[model samples]
Target: MDVDYVEYEDYTPDNESDNNITTELPFGSSQPSLSHVLVAINILISVIGLGGNSLVIWICLWKMKRTVITTWYLSVAVSDFLFCAFLPLEVFYMMTSHWPFGLVLCKVTSSALFLNMYSYVFLLVLISVDRCVMISFPVWSHNHRTVGKALGVVVLVWVLSALLTLPSLIFRQTTVRGSVTQCYTSYMGPSKHKAVVLTRFICGFLIPFLVIVFCSSVLCVKLRRLTIKSTKPYKVMAALILSFFICWVPYHSFVLSESDLKNHSVEVLETGLKVGTTLAAANSFISPVLYVFIGNDFKKILKRSLTSRIEEAMAEDFRTVGLNHSKSKSMEIVKS
Candidate 1:
């Protein structure tokens, strides 16, 4: 369940027959070179992603007033925040090549990682649909877009994500071999393992990917027909979708390739898996950059601290008076 690339060592228990073989790793030589590099990458990701995602959650959920898009983003931030929370354990596992936290943590951390990924993609789909609705039927969206409904959908997505993560939890285990501790998914058979990977690729990646693409296409057509000048919102959505695709597609593709897991050598698969996982993990931190660049208000709010935003909120009357003075001056100039 931990983010790991394990090379299992086969052993047969003294009390067991030859047929009762077990796959385990002995406390032998550690892969210090690879472990050091992976540990460094994870530490970097944890520090940046945890901070960026926390800021996003704070801004969208608390600092800014709730809107449909903000509510959707709030869900994403929550998932990323939870994902970041477990990074220390992953880092520890990578550095030492052992699972010290025991079996339950192994299952929970693995399940949480996949759960967050699924939840993230599902939220993106919802955001795309919301945008498509806004563009295609502005009147209906104006009347029907409610925070309560958006929150309800968020709750449903969480439920779905948890359900999807259950298989990983069920399959995950902690195996010890000669003082070496390992956390891994010990599928009953290769068939079962392949099935799980296929399921994840389809449910967690393919379906949501298709939905986002379809929504984007429809939204583009509607905007083109309407002759809209402001495409900032669409641009923001596109950035989000593109980032998600870039970050996740490689991971999913590598996973799907694992259906033929026997063909891959341990060293080769480990390297590829590590690279894919690093890319996938990058999404948590990169998203905040996209938000700042593509979201109109995100940069403005981030530029100022919480106290500054509160002060601005308190000085609403002063800002309104200034705006009125500017308007009056412009009117007089026009008349002259």
Candidate 2:
């Protein structure tokens, strides 16, 4: 999402004046009904995301053993949980179109949004690559993959994501426009704005998406070659990757298109962006739901506790992969 601002024409600060700056809102305030609808949807997303991600965090941290898979799941859950935690501020801003939170909270909230964006996608990429490596070189992966190394990688992802989010912190500011106060990004010029948008589209969406697709493709080919009969693990992974692509592509597309102001109507673009962002936000909770449904049998999930079902799903996927690898290895030994 772009900086948190209200719907209004762009303004530029005077060279000699310190107070004026250009701004735009995440959603338009022209339609009070739309704002209300957005507020309702965002509140719902926040509630579901908070509950779902919290459950995943608790299950991953306490119920499951500390393994690479669990580490990735825990890290992703934490990222989503933090994002959902900060959503109320956005909900407030959207409902009132007034930012009384001051500049620091403004920056923090915006930064958290992107932090969740980058960290979540990067973690997904890591998971996909890890799965591929596990399939391709089971012995090496078994020996080299460790919870400690996974933690290091997760920390690195967070650090890189934070670095990418600095622009949001640097540009976000709170300013009073008459009776209303707005928090928005003041990029000062089109060049700077274009650069930020392009960076987000490329790093936050394009590259990570390509990598995930490649890894998924490779995994599919490898699994077919191995003649693996159980498709549950693949199904779960496919649902995750597909859901991410569905949720994020619209947001990125609308944002990237907004960069070219002449080609698109401002109102249309803004509306599209709001809708896209809602879809993107939906991704945070969707992962946990996917874990429940795609990861396990529905009947069994109904009988088991939520945590037990999730744990079983995680362990079941890992066990399936190991079993497939063992079978392949045994076949090779027999041939030898």
Candidate 2 vs. true structure, TM-score: 0.84
Candidate 2: tens digits of C-alpha lDDT, residues 1-336: 352343233643232143334467545545657767777888998999999888778767755567898788788889989989989898888777788988899899877778888998899899899999999999999999999999999999999999999988998777777777777778766677778888988999899989998998999889888966677766867787788889889887877787776788877877777778878888888878877777654324333455454555555576677766645544444343
Report, for every candidate in turn, its global Cα lDDT versus the true structure. Answer: 0.74, 0.77
**How close is each model in CA RMSD to the real structure?**
7.1, 10.4
Off by over 4 Å in 1: 6-32, 262-266, 306-336
Compose the digit string of candidate 1's lDDT tens values, residues 113-139: 788888999999999999988888889
Worst 10 residues of 1 by lDDT: 20-29
Model 2 segments more than 4 A misplaced: 1-9, 12-21, 297-336
- The clash count for each model shown is 0, 1
